[model samples]
Target: MPSPMVSIINVSKRFGALQALDEVSLEIPRGAVQCIIGPSGSGKSTLLRCINQLEPTDSGAIFLEDELLGFERKGDKLLELSEGQIAGQRMKTGTVFQRFNLFQHMTARENIVEGPLRVLNRPRGEVMDEAVALLERVGLADKSGAYPAELSGGQQQRVAIARALAMRPKLLLFDEPTSALDPELVGEVLAVMHDLASTGMTMIVVTHELAFARDAASNVVFMDRGRIVEQGLPTTILTEPTEQRTRDFIGAER
Candidate 1:
C-alpha cells in the first residue's frame, strides 16, 4: 500500500503550563478532504501550525510523504533544521489562516506571484501567468488588480487561497478560515473551498462549519482538551459519533 501523504506520530506540543497537544497521531491520505472540529482553545490551530512547521514541536515527529519534517536524522540523533532549511521544507505545504495576511501595498496578482518569483526564483513572466490562472481558479480573476483593502472579506480570503495555490503545495492547511468573516460572507469563501475539494486537493481544514464538513469532507475528526475524541467518515462521525464527548460537542455545535 502507498504510504499516507501525512503521518503525524505521537505529536505533542506544550505552551508553558498548557498542554497544547497531547500525543496526537493521525494519517492523512492523499486527495482526502479532512475536517477537524473542536471548541475554542482546543488546540486546533496549534495542530495546523505544527503541520506547517510554523511552531516547533515539543515532542514526537511529523512526516510528509515519509520524510521527517523540521528535523533531519544524523546517526541516532534527531537534529532540528535551521531556519533556512525549515523554510524550504515548509514550501511543500500551503497554509491559509483566519486573517487573509496579504500585503496591503501589493495587488492581488502581485501577492499571488511573490512566493514563486522570490523564493522559488521562477521566471517573472511564467509566475505572473500562473498567478492569473490561480486567481481565476479561486473566482477572483477580475479582482487581481485590486488591493486587499479594496476587497470585501470574502474576496480577500479568496485571494488568500489563490496565493497559497500559487506555490503548488502538496498539502493545504486551513485554520478557522471563515471565523473572521461576517456570517453572510462565509458562503462565498466556503464555496471556493468546496470547489477546491472537488478538484482533489489534499486539504486539512480546521473549521466549525459542520454543513461544509458533512457535504465536502471525506473524514471528520473531533478533538477536545488536546486529544482526538474520535475520527471517522463524516456520515458516521458527524451523525452518529461513538464517544460521549463527541456527542456532547456535536450537540453544542448544532
Candidate 2:
C-alpha cells in the first residue's frame, strides 16, 4: 500500500510503575477500518490516546504524514513540534467516544457546528449546512433541534458522530463508541458505522463489539498486556485466530 497515513515505531508508555505500552509498532494504511480488541487495561485506550497526542508516550515515535506526533528520542534529529503545531495536525482527524460529550446548553445542530465555527472559523451558513448534512448522514436530521437531554443514549452518540463528521476530517477514531449504549440501541450505532466502513473512510477503532469488528473491519489487531498479540485480515483472525491467546480471549468473551 501507499505510505501509511499513520505510523508508530517502537512506541512505549509508562505510568508510574506500570508499562501501558511496550515497543508497539504498526502502520495503518489509508482508507481502511482497523479495530483493536483485548481485555480492559490492555493498553488499548492508551494506544489510541497516544496516536492523537492526547497522551505523551515515555518512548518511541509516531508519524502522521511527515510530522512527528509526539515522543522525542534522544539524538534523533529532534523535529519536535509545539502544542499548536500538533493541534493543527490533529484537526485533520476526528474522534467519537463512548460518552456522547454533547453540549447540554446547545441544540444538536449547534453542538455539531460549534467546533467548526470556533476552531476552523468557518462561515455560519457553511457550518450550519455541514452540520445538517452530517446529522442526516448519522440518521439524526430530526434530532438536530433537540438537546442531549431530549435524546436517547443512541441518539446522542449518533449526534456525536455527526459532530465529528462536521470537521470533514481525513480520518476517524472510535474509542469503544457503542460500549455505553443499550443492547437495543447498539445495533443502530453499529449500522451507522457499517455504512461508514462501506464508504472506505480510514478508521481506527478500539471496540468490544467482536461481530462488528469482524464484519466491518478490513484488519483486526489483538492487543494484550501492552503488546500486539496478533494482526491480520479480519476473516482469519475472527474465524481462525492463530494465537492461543486469541482463541482463549475470544472464548472467555463468549
Candidate 3:
C-alpha cells in the first residue's frame, strides 16, 4: 500500500497552561482534501502549525510521506535536524494564512517567484515562466505586475495562493484563508481553492466555511478543546455527526 501523505501519531502540544493539541492523530491520504472545523481556540490552526513544523509538538511525531518531520532517527536516538534541514523539510508543505501575507513591496509575480529563485535557486527564466502560469492558474494573470496594496483583498489572497503553489509543495495548509476578506470577495478566493481541489492537490483546510467543507473536502474533522471530537466523510460528519460535540459545533456553524 502507498504510504499516507501525512501522518500524525499521538501528537500533543502545550502553550504554558493551555494545551494546544492533545494526543491528536490523523492520517491524510495523497490527493485528498481534509477540512478541519471547530470553534475558535479548538487547536485547528495549531494542528496545521505543528504539521508544518512552525510549532513543535511536545510529544509524539508527525511524518510526511513516511519520512519523520523535524528530526532524524539514528540508532536508538532521535536527533533534531539543523535549521537548514528543517527549512528544507518545511518547503514541502506550503501554508496560507488568514491574512494575506504577501510582501508589500513586491509585485504578485515577484512574490510568486521569490522562493523558487532565492531558496531553491532554480533557473530565473524557468521560475518566471512558472510564476506566470501560477498567476494564471489562480485567475490573476493580468494582476501579476500589481503590488499587494493595489489589489483587492481577494486578489491579494489569490496572489498568496499562487505564491504557495510556486514552490510545488506536496501539501497545502490553509488557515482561515478567507476570513479576512469581505463577504463579496470571499467567493473569489474560495473559487480558486475549489479549482485546486478539483486537481487533486492534497489540502488540509482550517475553515468555518461549511459549504466548502461539504462540497470540496473528502473528509471532515471536528475538534474541540485540543482534541478531535469526530472525523469521517464530510456527508456524515457535516450532516449526521455521531458525537454531541460535533453536532453542537456544526449546529452553531450554521
Candidate 4:
C-alpha cells in the first residue's frame, strides 16, 4: 500500500489532571472519508484537534505531506518550529466547527476570501474568482452578497464550508458538521458533505449519525475514553465490531 497522507505516531496529550489522549496512533491515507464515532468526550474531538495541532500534544509527532505538523524538539535541540510556524501549518488543514464560524462583519463572499487574501497573500482578483467558484460549488452562489445575519443556519454553514474550501486545503476537518443545524435543516448541510465525499476529497469527520457513518464513510474509527478502541471498514466496524466497547456504544445509540 502507498504511504498515508497523514501519519500520527505515538501521540499523547494531557491537561493538568485529565489525560485527553493516550499514546494514540493513526494513519489517514489520501482521499479517504474516515468517520470517528464515539460517545462525547471519548477523545474523538481531541484526536482531531491534535491532528491539526489545534491542541498541543505533550509528546507526539504528526506528519503532513512535506512538513511536520508537530515535531519533537527541546533540551538543547538545535531548532524547533515556533508557535507561529505551527499555526501557519495548521491553517493548511481547513476546519469546520459545530457552530458555523463565519465572521458577522463580513459578507459571504468576503468571508470566503478573507483567509486567502490575508493568509495566502494571493492577488485580489484571483482570490475573488476562486471564492466565487467555491461558493457556487457549495450552493451559495446567489448568497455571496448577504451577510451572516441575513442567511439561515444552513446557508451560513454552507458558506462556512465554502470558506474552508476556498483555502484549497489538502485535508478537511469537520467536527460534528451538522450538530448546530435545525433538525429539519440538517439534510442540506449533509448533502453538501456527501457531494464533497463523492468527489474523493480527503476528509475526517466526527459525527453521531450512524447511517452516515455506515453509508458515507470509507472507514469507521470507534473511540472511547482517550483511546481508539476499534477501527475498520465501515461494514466490519458497524456490524461486526470486535471490541465490546465498540459494540456496546453502537448498541446504546441504536
The TM-score measured for candidate 1 stands at: 0.98
Per residue, candidate 2 scores C-alpha lDDT tens digits across 115-166 of: 8999899999988888888999999888889989999999998888888888
Which portions of model 1 miss their true places by more than 4 Å?
Answer: none
Candidate 1 Cα lDDT to native: 0.93
Tell me how candidate 3 scores on lDDT.
0.94
Poorest 10 consecutive residues of model 3 by lDDT? Answer: 71-80
Candidate 2 minimal-lDDT segment of 10 residues: 70-79
Worst 10 residues of 1 by lDDT: 132-141
List the candidate 3 regions with Cα displacement exceeding 4 Å.
none
What local distance difference test score does each model get?
0.93, 0.87, 0.94, 0.87
- What does candidate 3's lDDT look like per residue over 1-254, in tens digits? 99999999999999999999999999999999999999999999999999998897888889999799988899987788898999999999999999989999999999999999999999999999999899889888899899999999999999999999989999999999999989999999999999999999999999999999999999999999999999999999988999998888889878
Best-matching candidate per lDDT: 3
In order of appearance, the predictions have TM-scores of 0.98, 0.95, 0.98, 0.94
